[model samples]
Target: MAKIWVFAEVNNGKVDTAALEILTKARELGGEVEAVALGPGSTDAAKELGQYGATTVYASDDEVYADYVAQPAAHALHELVKEHAPELILFATNYDSRDIAGRLSARTGSTLMSNCFDILGTDKARTTIFGGATVVDVALEGTPKIALVRPKSFEPEASGGEANVMPVEVDIPDDLKKAKRVERHEEQASGPKLEEAPIVISGGRGLQDASNFELLDQLAGAIGNAAVGATRAVVDAGWVPYAYQIGQTGTTVKPGVYIAFGISGATQHIVGMKGAKTIIAVNKDEDAPIFQIADLGIVGDALKILPQLIEEIKTRKG
Candidate 1:
């Protein structure tokens, strides 16, 4: 049997959904699945990690990981790699994970395959290239191959067991702690997060103005559990925050129901949401490329149709 390790990131006192997803996939690859968790709540999150198929968890509640950036964790992970010698290491495709993976790659001289959506046996992973139009298999060569997996690539499952937790020990020199975290600010959001939401309502340049996003807000409000998202074009135009942007350069969402408003469906944008279970696209242009993939297509002005749709939803709910 092979040995695999997953970097399980924790958020809001729980294991990150993406990490759990990766853990589940790692378990399916017929390996001895282990996890490395850091930060304040990592030890507490180990039980959940075990429930998601991790047989063992190397947990570190050291403040250095939370107080500073990626260097300290990278150094610690490098030491762990030398000691344990896992055949493969999996990481979630997120901000901190990417930072740590890059630094660790430099330290270990390993082949890092990023944006992978599937693991093919023990030596290959599948990813999309050229704006997600072409699918290719990447070889995982060299010792302790590292792979960064995309969000929503696999469904998470619980093994109904607890993992044996062990403490991670490493010494960090002062030079590695140059960059320190002074403060942190998070956006105040309601309902579900955009990536985790079952229903996603998105807008694009066809909305005409920033104020038109209010229509999406109203629709989300009416839907009760839906989250709002925007295209890169609208986000660049200052219509919404970068967090709401969904594209090749932004967040990737695979909601159960994805409703697109006025998006022309560029390949960059489609790469992010094409995995959605059902896609509904509304655009005035009948020949829009989005219509090619949309399960339901509406040929009309999105701005004009939004008000009527909101009222109808409100009336139906009432």
Candidate 2:
């Protein structure tokens, strides 16, 4: 049996879905699965980890470590790994976890195998390369291998089993605690998070201007639960925020249904969303690269098509 230690990330005093997904996957791997829940938010979420198959939850509700600076939590994780010596440590590929994983890898002198889409063997993992044009399998050689998993790679399962929550203290060095959080501005979201949404409708620069994104918003409203996304080009052009960009430099999405409007399917953008279950592309260019991968390719002007689509969906639903 493999010995797995998963870093369970908490947000707003709840166990984040990304953490729970890995925890469930850890259980499926047939191992002694333990969860390390760090920061002030972890205290309220330790029990939630148990329900997802974290047999033992090592928790630290320290205020100093609450903010994710990649220092204090990395230090704590390094100490735990040294003492417990688990064969594997798992981290989500989200922002904070990536920072913590890199810091922890350097501290432990281990090479981090990252953005793994699947666990092939005991120490064998799979990831993409060459702008996601290739999938390669690699074997990790370190004593306790560290792996960062991609988001939306798996679905979360809740298997209600109470965990033995043990409160542990991690010493934060003066240097690591020097920085303090001043303010936070949460992103205003009306529907499911982009990574978690089942349907995603992404627009590109072909939409002409930022104001035209309202067409996407209206289409999303018609779809009822769809999320709007954009290509990096549109985002860089100041037509959309970086948060909405979907590409190698932005967010990787694996929605069930992915609709591309006016996107030419640049390799950078395809790297992020090629994993979507069903792909639909709409662009005036019949030979756009996006059509190569799209399950349904519509050669038409998106601006002319989207308005009709929205009305059609609304009418059908009504």
Candidate 3:
């Protein structure tokens, strides 16, 4: 039986949803599921992971691990993998996870699958593809296989039983220690994380200018639980934060309802949001590419349409 290991990420005492999603998938794979948390006293984090199907939680409480730097954290996880010799290492496809996955693969000489949507059974080996396209079923050519699963790909299952917690010591390699983090910056708290938002309103270059972005913010606020998103073009124009961009180069979102306002819907952008349960597109161009994928499409100017739509939504909610 191959043991499965999940790298649980914790920031400001809260476990990332992606970490729980990985643990849920690990449970489906069966065998002992061990979650590893490396930070300053992440015992509470480890216990929370146990509720999500982590049988064993390995925690490393070290000052060096306090800062969320990739090098030291990767080294710590690598050391844990070396000791446990798990068959599969699962990580969330966030920036940190991508960095760690690459390093772990190189260190262990294991196959790496990044940004996998679903893990289809492991007979010959674990199977996953990029952007949920091009199926690549691979059996581990090496002892351990590394995989970075996309966030929101799998729903998190409830944690059962108390997780067995243990403390582990990792010697940070001199080479890794050399790469030190000088500063840490945090983004101002936006209304809600785009991915976690139930309703999302996204804009593109069709909106015209940065000044038009106020319409997007107004519409989002009208919808209450809505979050704002931007297409690649609008993001490139410096209208919104890169984190709010949705596309191949940006965040992949799976919202209950996704509204693409003024977006032409490039294939790269569509690929990221095609998983949305219900898609509504509003673009002035009748031949916009976004219409093909949208459940409902309106051929009209976003500036004029948005204000009216906001009024209607407000009326209906009231």
For each candidate in turn, the TM-score is 0.96, 0.93, 0.91
lDDT of 3 by residue, 86-195 (tens): 88788888877787788878888888876666765432333334434566655545668777777778899876757999887777766766656677676844787888
Q: Candidate 3 regions off by >4 Å? A: 66-68, 122-139, 316-318
Which candidate should be chosen as best, given lDDT against the real structure? 1
- Candidate 2 error regions (>4 Å): none
- Please say which candidate is ahead in lDDT: 1 or 2: 1
Report the lDDT tens digits of candidate 2 across residue range 1-318: 668989988766877788888888888888898999888778678888999999889998887676647788888899998888888899988878888899888888887898897876558789989777798999988778899888667788999998898887667778886556667776757897787789999999789999999999999988978999999999999998788988776788899999999999999999889989999999999989999999999999999999999999989999
User: Candidate 3: TM-score?
Assistant: 0.91
The positional error of residue 244 in candidate 3, measured at the CA in angstroms, is 0.8
Best by TM-score: 1
User: lDDT of candidate 2?
Assistant: 0.87
Error of 2 at 109 (Å): 0.4
Error of 2 at 50 (Å): 1.3
> Order the candidates by TM-score, highest first — what do you get?
1, 2, 3
Model 3 lDDT, residue 289, Cα = 85
**Between which residue pairs do clashes occur in model 2?**
none
